[model samples]
Target: MNGILETILVIVGIIWVIVFLLALFLSPKLSATKSKNGGKK
Candidate 1:
C-alpha cells in the first residue's frame, strides 16, 4: 500500500514537472503573440 502510494505520488510529481516546463517554454511565445496582437482580446 505504501509503495503504491509512493508510485502514484511520483507519477503526479513528474506530470506537474512536465506541465511546469511546457509553460515555461511556451510562455514567452505566448506573450510575444499577445503583444503582436495588440495586448488585448
Candidate 2:
C-alpha cells in the first residue's frame, strides 16, 4: 500500500510539472494574442 501511494505521488508530481511547463511555454503566446486582440483571450 505504501509503495503504491508513493508511485501515485510521483506520477502526480510529474504530471503537475508537465502542466506547469506547458503553461509557462504557452503563456507568452497567449498574452501576445490577448494583447493584440485587446485582451480577448
Candidate 3:
C-alpha cells in the first residue's frame, strides 16, 4: 500500500511540473499578444 501511494504521488508531481512549465512558457506569449493588440480596449 505504501509503495502504491508513493508511485501515485510521483506521477502527480510529474504532471504538476509539466503543467507549471507549460504555464510559464505560454504566459509570455499570451502577454505579448495582448500587448501587440495595443491594449486598445
Candidate 4:
C-alpha cells in the first residue's frame, strides 16, 4: 500500500511540473494573442 501511494505521489508531482512548464511556455504566446485580439481576453 505504501509503495502504491508513493508511486501515485510521484506521478502527481510529475504532472504538476509538466503543467507548470506548459503554462510558463505558453504564457507569452497567450499574451501575444490577447494583444492581437485587442486585449479582449
Q: Which candidate number has the best TM-score?
A: 4
lDDT, residue 13, model 2: 100
RMSD of each: 1.2, 1.2, 2.5, 0.7
- lDDT tens string, model 4, 1-41? 99999999999999999999999999999999999989878
Global lDDT of each candidate = 0.96, 0.96, 0.92, 0.98
Model 1: lowest-lDDT 10 consecutive positions: 32-41
> Tens-digit lDDT track for model 3 on 1-41?
99999999999999999999999999888888988999443
What local lDDT does model 4 show for residue 3?
Answer: 100
Index of the highest-lDDT prediction: 4
Per-prediction backbone clash count: 0, 0, 0, 0
lDDT at 20, model 2 = 100
Error of 2 at 30 (Å): 0.4
- Tell me which residue pairs clash in candidate 3: none
Lowest lDDT sum, 10 consecutive residues, model 2, at 32-41
In terms of lDDT, model 2 sits at: 0.96
Model 2 clash pairs are none
Candidate 1 per-residue lDDT, tens place, 1-41, comes to: 99999999999999999999999999999999999999875
Clashes of 3: 0
Model 4 poorest ten-residue lDDT run: 32-41
CA lDDT for candidate 1: 0.96
